[model samples]
Target: MKSLTNEVLHYTLFVMILETIEQYYTWALIAILLLNFSQRKIPNSQKKRFATIYLAALLLIFEVGVVTILTRGWPQKLAFLDLAICAALFYFFREKAWPFRFHCVNCNEKLDMNHIIGHDDNLCQKCYYEAHPEEAAKEEEKNKKLEPEQSSETLGLQDIPDTVSEIDWDIWEPREVCVITYLFENDQVLLIDKKRGLGTGLVNAPGGHIELDETAKEAAIREFKEETELDITDPIMAGRLDFQFKDSLSERAYVFFAHTYRGTPKETEEARPFWCPVSEIPYEKMWEDDQYWLPLALEGKKFEGRFIFDDQKMLDKSITVEEEDNE
Candidate 1:
């Protein structure tokens, strides 16, 4: 009776251990499936087929373990049946099941593993560049314009510069980084009449200098709220402005566009808030650069502009609008 009781306890412990392992395996498989499905870079059909095979294999392994535990020994016939089913599944879905491609789809060139897994197009680097000539050109241009390692010395000039070409932007550092946010609602945009500071009395978007350790986006949100008492949401970066002011103030401002906001716009000590129709922006009353780039921004375009400013008057300017990629 004692020997029989010990044997029963041993089987019970084995069953518990098997159940614990099965639970862990099930959870791990679920996590892998979720990760696979969430991946946007991989093809959907490939992800689904891989998930199916993985699930089937996991279920088969669990079934074999369960059968072995229940029968007090490994079920040889059941194990063999599971193997055969896996083999059949692999045979039927070989192309879909295989994740690695040995050749470029475009040029039939031999590809490394990085090309097979890293690229959704299954093309090698050379073939990829050939297929995307514009992207190749952009890459080459970017490589040619590498930033210099040394920073430029302060100009310390007694006279304010009159031309944008006087400053080398590659090594030029800004004294202050600022951010501006334009809130759009329907056909109107929120604008502020500056009451104090640099552009006092000029019409502009709500903006201020970035505080220490704060990101440009965070600073934009804070400045908008402080000036207009409104909480803006989903602020999308639209452009950047590099200002070389004659007053020895070098500023780089990141511009953002927000369409959603909460709270009402109220006048503050720093600015007076108002809603102006998109078609009727008072450009003459605002900074001169606004007339050139604000229109493009309203049309959902990205731009970068460099300006040499003498107080509120712009001396020289260069604006570049980025080409939109519809793809």
Candidate 2:
């Protein structure tokens, strides 16, 4: 009985539906044309899309309202509810019922209303690795060997993605750089809270980006002053760490420690500088490979490192600790 009622109602609505739809179509076309005529700063694609949606919503409301007005000859039973429901549906569809967007990790392409399979980094046949089989083979072999053969324990960290959020894997570009300055005092290595993007809420060395129009040493001094709020009088550059992470959004860090400085360390939004015993640190909360290479720096030793992380966020990573070529 319910099915019969639905079928009869559907046929009745279907006949009048075209006329109802036409009314809405007219309103939509006019609205979008007017929007284009206005010429706003909004991007062309966004402008057209927003205009279409706005028109569609108006169409729905007008169609339902007119249908009730025509059939009942005026507002009557269920007319208000029908109009309200149409408006509510338009709101819901516009705000919440949109399709999920898939982004290409390598190319940063966003696709709307489509599932792009095999488009991501190595998930499909047309992936970059497939185009370069030799490189892909080598990569797989190296990845297999990266893990320790003897024990389940791995030599380097495996949280690749989070560790290398700053690098462009397909292309090398140094957008942002950092300098980690460690102060050796009374058998304690000073560690500071990051107070910035990656490890903002986490503990890290007191350092920051090497800005333009400033020498690296000068940048280091400025960063130390800004973060630690301690003015270093004689911060002779000991060495540097070139942390290379394999990611699109991750950055290579140039870490430098100073043995000599002036003023007392204080707390700031960037970091609260304090001395930690060289033997103990909250390694779990730091850059995944901090402990492996930081010790060399703390021992008054100079070295550069090449660390790779899969993701652009977090410190989980794999590291190749080596001495710097320049040093």
Best by lDDT: 1
Worst 10 residues of 2 by lDDT: 114-123
Off by over 4 Å in 2: 1-171, 236-247, 310-327
Write candidate 1's Cα lDDT for 147-249 as tens digits.
3232222455564468888667775656666888999999999999999998998999999977755656777889999999999987887888888877677
Q: Estimated TM-score per prediction?
A: 0.57, 0.42
TM-score, prediction 1: 0.57
Residue-level lDDT of model 2, residues 54-166, one tens digit each, is 65566667665666566655524345566587667766765432322365444445643222311223122234443333233344335545632421122234322343433
User: What is candidate 2's TM-score against the reference?
Assistant: 0.42
Model 1 poorest ten-residue lDDT run:
144-153
